[model samples]
Target: MTAPLLEPPGGRPLRIGSRTSLLATVQARHVAELIHEYAPGVATEIVPIRVSADVWDGDLSRIGGKGAFSKEIDRALVAGEIDVAVHCMKDVPGDVPLAEGTAFGAYLERGDVHDVVVTRDGTPLADLPPGSVVGTGSVRRRAQLGMYRPDLRTERIRGNVDSRLARLNEDGSGYAALILARVGLDRIGETAQPQEVLPLEFHQADEGVVSMVPAVGAGVIGVQARQRDLAVMSLLGGLNHDQTARHILAERSMLHELRGHCNSPIAGYATTTADGAMSLHGMVFNRDGSELVRFHCSGSPDDPAALGSEVAAELLRLGARRLIDATGG
Candidate 1:
C-alpha cells in the first residue's frame, strides 16, 4: 500500500541545490524526478549555485581541495536557502566529515564505475605513441596512467566535461587523450563512443590489461539535507538503494580512515556478493605511479565499515602512508 505523500511545509516545493554546471544540473533534475516517482504530489525546484571550484582554474588543493565543489551549496543548504543538495560522491572529500548540520539523505543506485579513455583519432590507449600526453586532473589517474604506460606523459586538465572535450579537440591542445569517468559521460549524454573504456577488474584478460581502481564513491549521486529535517530525510530515504549504500559505506569507511584528499593518490572500490558478503579493494600510489600499495579484504555486508577499515589498515601497514604524505594529503 502507498503511504500518503509528505509534502513540504505550507505546500512549498522543495528547492534542490546544485552546482551551476550542465552535468550537475542534469543530476539535480534526475533527483527531482526520483522524488516525483517516490511521491507523486511532492514538488521539487532545482537551484543552481556557482561554487569556488568552478571559477578557480588553478590547482584544487590550493582552495581546500575537492570540498570546494560543495562548500557553497552546502552553505545554502545549511542557511535554509535550499532543501537538499545534490553532489557527486567522488567530489565529496573524505579527509573530513560533512558539514556540521548536513547529512546524506540517500545515495542513488551506482552507475558505471569504470573510466574511459578518449582519443582524438579513436586510438586505443595501448596504441598511443610513446611520449603521448594524457590529460586529467586527478592524481590517482595520473599515477595509474604512469603505472600502465610509463612512456606516456600527463598534463592537468580541468573544467566541465564539455570544456575538457573541447580542449582535447582543439588543435595543438597537446592532449593525446583524456581519461574521464564513464558515468559522467553517461549523465551528460556525451559518451557516444569512446576510444577505450577501461574495466574495474584487476588484470582480467578479456576486459583490459590495465586495472583502473575507481575513486571512493565514484559513479554515485548523494542527496544531502539538514540533519534535523526529519520530513525531508523521510522523503529521501525511500530513494536509497541498499546494495549501493552498503558498497559506498565500505569504500568511504576506508577513505575516511586513510584521510585521503584531492591530491592524494588514493583509489578504493567496494563490491558485494550474492551471499551477503562485501569486499573492498584499496590502493595508494606515488605521484609518478612508480610505486603502489594495494590491499583487499572481505567481510559480512552487514559490517561494511569494518571490512573497509581492515583494507585500509592493511594498505597503511604496507606503506601507503608514505605515498599519501608525499603528496601533501
Candidate 2:
C-alpha cells in the first residue's frame, strides 16, 4: 500500500518557496500553517523570490505570461533551495518538466475553478450599463465575454488581484467593471465586496471552480525532495489533496491533447460529481468567441485524463486543428 507518513522531517525548519505577491503569500502561508498544525515539531518558513514575469512593462506578451512566473521557482526546487514550492495551480502549464528521473508529487485542495466577472454595484452583468468595460488578460475570458456582450469593450489588465482591483474606480473614469477569477477573490478574502460577482456558468469561469492551466509538471506541490530526501516527501504526502490531483490530471490532459499555449484559444475544465465521476467541459475559439465550439465528456469519470484526451481528439476531428493552425494558436 502507498501509505503516507504521518509527519515530515522533524526538527528541520522546511522552507516553502513562493512569489511575494499577496495572493501567493496567502497561499504559501496556508500550506505552512497546515504543516505546522499537522507536525508540531517540524518548523516552517517562507522564501519570497521575484520573477521577471511580474515586472510588467506594459507588454505581457514578451514577459512570458504564466510559465515565466513558475520556471524560476521550479529551478529553486531543482537546486534544493527550498524543500517545496507553493504555487497557484492555474498558473502552472500543462506539462511537468524536471530533470529526467524526477517527477512532481502532490497538490492542494483546489479553489473555485470557474472564472467570475466583477461588475459595479453587485449588479448582474446583464444589468451593467451599456458599453461597460470588462478587463481581463485571458484570451478565453475575453472571447467568452465578447460572445455575451457584443457591444461591451474588453481590455487587457494585468497585475496582482489587488493591483487590478485598484484600477476599478469609485468614479466611472476607470473601466466600468473588471473580470477576475472567483478563486483569487476568495483566496484574498475579497469575494463579496467587489462590485458585481458575475455568475460563472454564463461567465465561463464562475464561483466554485478554477480554470486551471499549470506550468508543465507544476500541478502537484506537495514536495520534490530527492529520493534520498524521503522525509520531505513523506511530510508533503500528508498535505496532499487527492481530488486536487484528479482535477489537475483531467485539466492538464485536455491541454496536452490540444497542445495549447498562451496564444492558443483553447480552454478546458474538469469537475468531479457526487457519483464520483468526472465531467469535462472544453472549448476552442477563434480570436472572437462568436465562432466558439464547445463539448462535454461524460463516462466512468475515473479515467479523467482518458476522457479529456478523447474530447481533444473529437475537437481535432471537428476541425479544431485547422482552426488553431489558421489562427496561429
Top model number, TM-score: 1
Give the per-residue lDDT digits (tens) of candidate 2, residues 1-329: 23334343554578888888888888889888878776766778898877666766354446555667777777777787777777666566554444333345558776655456675566667666778787887777777666667677887887788888777755654687777777678789886654443443433433323232212223234344444467667777776788777766776787777766665666776767788788777778776666756677875656768887887888887777766665552
Can you give the TM-score per candidate against the true fold? 0.96, 0.84
Q: Across residues 83-176, which tens digit of lDDT does each residue of candidate 1 receive?
A: 9999999999998778888899899999999889998778999889999999998898898888878889899898998889989999998999
lDDT of each: 0.88, 0.66
* Model 2 segments more than 4 A misplaced: 1-12, 57-59, 95-102, 170-173, 199-228, 326-329
Off by over 4 Å in 1: 1-5, 204-208
